[model samples]
Target: MSDYLSNPLELFSVAGKVAVVTGASGAFGEVAAEVLAAAGAKLVLAAGKKAELAAIAEKCRARGAEVAEVNVRPTSEAVCDELVRTAVATFGRVDILVVASGKNDVAKIVDMAPERFLDVMDANVTQSWLVARAFTKQLLAQGGGGKIVLMSSARGLLGHPAGYTAYCASKSAVDGITKALGCELGTQGITVNAIAPTVFRSPLTAWMFEENDNATAVRKGFLGRVPVGRLGEPQDLAGPLLFLASAASDFYTGHVLYADGGYTAG
Candidate 1:
């Protein structure tokens, strides 16, 4: 993992490469992009809000990355196409794609509004597919293969007591896409993978952790038993992120690496 000259394999260093990350405005995403930038990547950050993305880009630029912007609207074609095009125009090549766009709503299936379910699915799963399609084409043109990471959830792997039907189904779709994409792109030197996390301490997850009488009350005993004895941290995910983004994972495709601190062990 050393980028030091003393270690020859350090060529795996992401220096000078370009990485395109979706959902760049969010906490987990900003952290991930910072990690990549520190390790030497020219970042192309895409998020919904222009001002938020401008801030993320400013930080990455300070770290020496060339930046670009894309809104996550109309995922079917426009945004994804624009994302790939923007990166290529700015950095001249695409080396990594991190599909971190997501949406979630906890409601019983019976009560989940049709619009809400569709919105979550489009954001979580459909956007990923659209972006992958764009990234793959550019990766093929670059001709050395590419690394793709999809953001999924532990909810996709297990049943939850809460009404997470829509969220769970969307995440499960991410897993399936990773598998199908791995097969379809493997022959072209593209590796596709998914990361399923459990309750990471990010803006997306902080709401649930805020002590609510009814919620935290029901989970008082369970909190004491998390095997890791601590909530998931952004730093805790860096190692695996690096692995999947570098040549170290060249042979790994269609795999979902769980970083849930034993949430699925039992």
Candidate 2:
């Protein structure tokens, strides 16, 4: 409405915005941090691994972005709250939150102990909820609209034949939270959305990218379902992430932007 028609690229500019990225040590977390950093955002990165967190912070700093590192997981409400405080203390305000701190425990429902299932839920579902809760409180207090970009997976929409019982269940819960929060914060000008990628080049899935016979067979089998005829790369996620984190997606919320290569289409 303000008329940026002359330079539409402004829609994606996150210059000087403050962002909080959890799971800063993980695959998607690194992508989120680097993307936000390259897009000119001040960063507050959190993770359980101090060395990894510091590495991410250093990369962002190298990009000329101010970064605050917190070597802790958002496992509890108190820790989540403190993370928000750190953002404000370092950057004055928070504008975006990327909940990337989650894990997958691959075990069939029959073989997985109840404790294992519960642990996966706590890591994926409970932690995401806590971080979102803390970030939302800060956004409301700051009296401005914000963005909450949640990390989901193709497993959220499609069931896997392998041992993905816990992983699938957890991501489905993430989708629910994204929708619920989007509705609740709509009036407040905040947007909530998720990025669901099937499989990308990450440490956990690195074997699928190898040139060995096992990797080749597995890759071919998987690609049979992917209409795009290729596995996902990290850059495949960057655009969608930028869109959700910037003004380009101001009118969009409660949506899941699938970065999969059409794997979920069928």
Candidate 3:
């Protein structure tokens, strides 16, 4: 091995790499963009809103990283293709893709509308597949390997009786997609993985963590199940994300790295 490769820490360097992060406006997406930029990756941030994506781009730029912003919804193949094109046009090539855009609707199966369930599936599963497919095509064209990180939820691995039917089902599909794509793309030098996190303090879940009696009761119940005795933080995902995005995880693919504070360990 070369001198640079001889150092263990050097394996985690993403310096000079180009990355495209979808759902850049969301909480986890914001953290992904910031962390990747800090790790020296040039970034292209895409999300549903232009203003939000622009804001994230500005933050990333301040970190001394090159950043491009694209307003896009990854549900359409055309939009997904355009996102990859924009990244390649801006940064020459993409080395990483983080699909962090997803939606969850809290409704019991008995009361869930078909449209609502489909919406969650489209947002979480279908959109993720489209984006990954487009990004993979670009990676194949360039004849270089890349990393794809899909955001899943701990609910995918465990059942929840609290009206998480659609969300859980959608995330479960994401996990399957991650494994399937990993198997198909391994020979092409692309690694596919998912980060499944437990309840985190994101805008979507802010109500659940609010300083209210109901929220406190909910938190207490959740804490009892989590071995770590706390909820996941945005920063908690940074290290695992960076590891999977870097050369250190070259031999690892189709794996679900649970950042659930040992909630799934039992």
Candidate 3, superposed: residue stretches over 4 Å from native = 1-6, 208-211
lDDT of each: 0.81, 0.94, 0.92
Report the alpha-carbon TM-score of model 3 versus the true structure.
0.96
Q: Rank the candidates by lDDT, best first.
A: 2, 3, 1
lDDT of 3 by residue, 67-89 (tens): 88888889799999989989888
Tally clashes: model 2.
0
RMSD for each of the candidates:
2.9, 0.7, 1.4
Candidate 2 per-residue C-alpha lDDT over 114-214 given as tens digits, one digit per residue, 9 for 90 to 100:
99999988999999999999999999998959999999999999899889999999999999999999999999999999999999999999999999999
lDDT of 3: 0.92
Q: Which of 2 and 3 is the better model by lDDT?
A: 2
TM-score of 1: 0.90
Clashing pairs in 1: none
Q: Per-candidate TM vs. native?
A: 0.90, 0.99, 0.96
Residue-by-residue lDDT tens digits, candidate 1, 1-266: 45555775664577777899998888767876887888888888888888888888788878876667675642768667877888888888899988777888889888988999998998888888898888888898888588999998788888777888888999999999999999989988889998888777786567556679765754455556468755688887787777888877888999988888887775
C-alpha lDDT of candidate 2 relative to the true structure: 0.94
The prediction achieving the highest lDDT against the true structure is: 2
